[model samples]
Target chain A: MLKRVHFPASLLPYLLVAPQVFITLVFFIWPASQAVYQSLLVQDAFGLSTEFVWFENFEYLWGNQQYRDTFGRTIFFSVAVAFLSMSFALILAGFADRVIRGSTVYRTLLIWPYAVAPVLAGALWLFMFNPTLGIIPFILDAFGRDWNHYLNGGEAMFLVIIAAAWKQVAYNFLFYLAAMQSIPRSIIEAAAIDGAGPVRRFVTVIFPLISPTTFFLLVVNAVYAFFETFGIIHAVTQGGPANATTTLVYKVYNDGFIGLDLGGSAAQSVILMILVIAMTVVQFRFIEKRVQY
Target chain B: MVEKRPGFTIVAHIVLIFGVALVALPVWITFVGASHDGARMLQAPIPMWPGDQFFENLRQTFFGRGLDGSRTAPVWMMMFNSLVMAMMIAVGKIAISLLSAFAIVYFKFPFRMGFFWLIFITLMLPVEVRILPTFEVVADLGMLNSYWGLTVPLIASATATFMFRQVFLTIPDEMLESARIDGAGPMRFFWDILLPLSRTNIAALFVILFIYGWNQYLWPLLITTDPDMMTIVVSIKQMLEASEQTPQWNIIMMTALLAMVPPIFVVIAMQKLFVKGLTETDK
Candidate 1:
């Protein structure tokens, strides 16, 4: 990865790298290792004594129905968020890519939502869905359907998913638009000459060309739903309505900080670490494959 | 244009307008909520149009204590804390990443790859996963409720370093060779040549990082327990929690608007640089 003509070996390199290396060691590496170590030890009630029991926490998690339910919920949440945001962004990008006029205006309007904090996003959506005074519920009231996320588990999950997906649409839209723009215009022209309609041309020509971007956005959106949506969940649901909205990351916070189950929390952290590493590997592999193309 | 399809063109405009409306809906609601008086905001089917109370709500949210019975700082104080945290993170990350990338690319040294991998590992383990232990570490160091605890742990970024490395690699070798022939030391060469050449990338990265730092929620929520130390982003959650008692939707929405304005302004103002930074760094 280095340059061909590089400077000779010197002590200055160590001096230069010291700040980043030091921060990583202290903040990232040390804490991560501590999580691994703590996962093997369980503290008794009242913080009295600790026993080293390797893999017991993991086994306990595997056997726990609530934890298994959270695992399933997290998968469902991530997939739904990815699918919703990606498809919404794909449609918007498709339209924006079609007409060359006012695209920048549309893009500027669309991309500002990316700057919003996830917590604020939650706040905005939570306000909109406020059962008493919410506009959405007010609209639904006219249709004779009740809307209240406070007591309804499905509605709570749906609210958090919408909030999360809303924040991510800007990012996915940008990538999809870029990908579509990079496709040669000649292909679409040839398709038009073959008497294919816009829908047929898009389904055959444009969709296949941007499949890589779609795949990449899929991974990115999953990771976003996994980790970055923590603020949205915290502000909106707090894993509420009987843990219907609690994902794995939310579970880690709840168990560790609120529930005061240190060993269990550490075990959850380690599991999350493994998930993140796996996702990163997949992302890098896909990126490298795209580079070769 | 590929072909003059009038019907498709009309359909495209309609879809784009609908998309923009959906995207803008939340912000518009927030804005309308912010503009009204408190009583009006609390009413069902809250007014969709902006109210004349905009300046009054802005004054109350910015200067007055946030939410009745809440023990938080004024909105301005939290905004100040957010600014400090964001500036420190953006500048600190760029500084350290530039140095490390320079050292790795230009100088051959012991454990170079070792250090590289160590930094790369930080990317895999996000702060969310290791929240407890990381919080414990910060608590042990007595850095809680401080800006150092808020920003430093989050600044150890591998993506920025890798981006800088890519930028450096693309620079022609002759620039460094000539600098060496001029008897310039490493730091001097870095200051004179590398930094200047990568200025655009640095500015672009700064915009992205600024938004990233400003929008951080969970880390600041955990660390900054002091009222004065709370960031604007974190305070929004506290205000939302407080709303259960008093339900001051107007002031809360005003605060939300203020929280989002800075970064949104940055993105809209520097659209080109932001797009470049985002696409290049992530890919």
Candidate 2:
């Protein structure tokens, strides 16, 4: 091992990072610990009265039927959204890589939605799905199909997934496109010269090379699906139509910020943190090795 | 790169066009929707033409009064908030990431690998996981409802630092050796050498971090209850939830579209930098 010695230059780097370090400790670590502490005691909405209850909040949260249902619903929503979005993004990215002459136009346009803030993205879709004024139902009605996101739970979930997926496709596309572009053209041409068809070449050569991107995106998208979709869900569904659209993070936001159940919200957050950490560990241990670059 | 087959090429064009259409559809909707007045908006198959009412809609979104009869805050106010917040986050994040990257890659340190993983772990947490704890931290420090609550917590993260470190590591050590032989101090060497060469990564990180900060919703929503302090994103959320009886679809669409302009402009304007930045990493 190289014996580590501090470089005088190192102080500059540490100084640069100092604000972040302070902020993270103050905002991230301290709040996380505070949440655990707050969880042991119940507090009123005014945030004034406090009563200590050992694991009482956790027990109440776990035992409640609504919490369990919301928990299951959240998992279902996360898994479904992640898989569906990534699958569509992957297929579209693969197809986009092959056909277009001026592909940069497509690339640039495709990534535009990602630039839209999630709040605006959600509003765009919600406006389309709006029962009274939205053009989506009108467009569907023209095709001999009637649609209402507000009335139908399944339709609402589908719209939520589509909304999430639409914003995300560009992100996945960027990674896939970058990876595909990196594959040596000569190597792909050599495979093509062997008379392998497009599908066959993609499956045998291109897919394996881009598998790293696929895996990385998988982890990235899954984490996104898990934690970040709260805004979309909140803006569009509000866990509506009998709590069908509720996800874990949304539920955390609801319970903590809205319901004023600080203890329960904190418990949910702790559990969520644990779940994320576990998934991350699994990715590093099992999946990261498969990434090519 | 594949051999051109005319028949296959036709099919590929169709697919590419279809993908572009799907991606572009929402943006087109936003543009048109922002133009139409509320009555026209409710009409089926929404008026395909851009309306002159775009100005009227814009007039209302910023200057029109709310149901409580308060004058609507200027669109520039929202833009300014976003601009200030995004700039703060970008400056803080870039400074932090670059310095951290420099320290890890260029300097000798004890427990370097351990620190690397500690930062790396943050990449997985995302803001969503740590938000609750993060919120509490702000509240505990009496920073809630302040700009620091919005700006400070966002500064720390592992992604950009990790990325920059990876890029910096690829720089040949001989350059640093030469600089050192010239009696340049470590600080001077970094400022004189590493900063210039790392421009591409810096540009890329700028776009990514700017977008990240600009797109933030839940944190700002949670921390700042004051409408004055509320970001454009949270403002849009509030507008979307406002009652149906008095709903102003035109202004809502306009505000939403208004929020989108800066980030899109940033991305388009910086497209070259974005591509160059990422491609350099693969080398």
Separately for all candidates shown, the number of backbone clashes (residues 3 or more apart, or on different chains) is 0, 3
- lDDT digits (tens) for residues B200-242 of candidate 1: 9999999999999999999999998899999999998888889
Which candidate tops DockQ? 1
The true-versus-predicted C-alpha distance at residue A206 of model 1, in Å, is 0.5
List where candidate 2 sits over 4 angstroms from the true fold: A1-17, A41-56, A142-146, A186-194, A285-288, A291-293, B62-72, B106-118, B275-283
Among all candidates shown, the one with the greatest lDDT: 1
DockQ for all models, in order?
Answer: 0.89, 0.53
lDDT of each residue in A1-293, candidate 2, tens digit only: 11133355445656655565655566666666776687788887687889899898889988999989887877777677667767767777777788657678778877666687766778888888777667788777879877877778888888888788778887778778878877888878999889898999989998998877777777677777777788888888888867778888888888776787888887888788788888777666654365544
Clashing pairs in 2: A27-B134, A31-B133, A32-B133
Per-model TM values vs. the true structure: 0.99, 0.90
lDDT of each: 0.94, 0.75
- Which digits, one per residue and each the tens of the lDDT, describe model 1 over residues A1-293? 88888889988999999999999999999999999999999999899999999999999999999999999999999999999999999999988888878888889989988999999999999999999999999999999999999999999999999999999999999999889888888888999999988888889999998999988999999999999999999999889999999999999999999999999999999999999999999999999887322
Lowest lDDT block of 10, candidate 2 chain A: A1-10
lDDT tens digits, residue span B2-109, model 2: 776788877777887887887777777888888987878766677766888888788777665432322335666767788888988987888877876777776665
TM-score of 2: 0.90
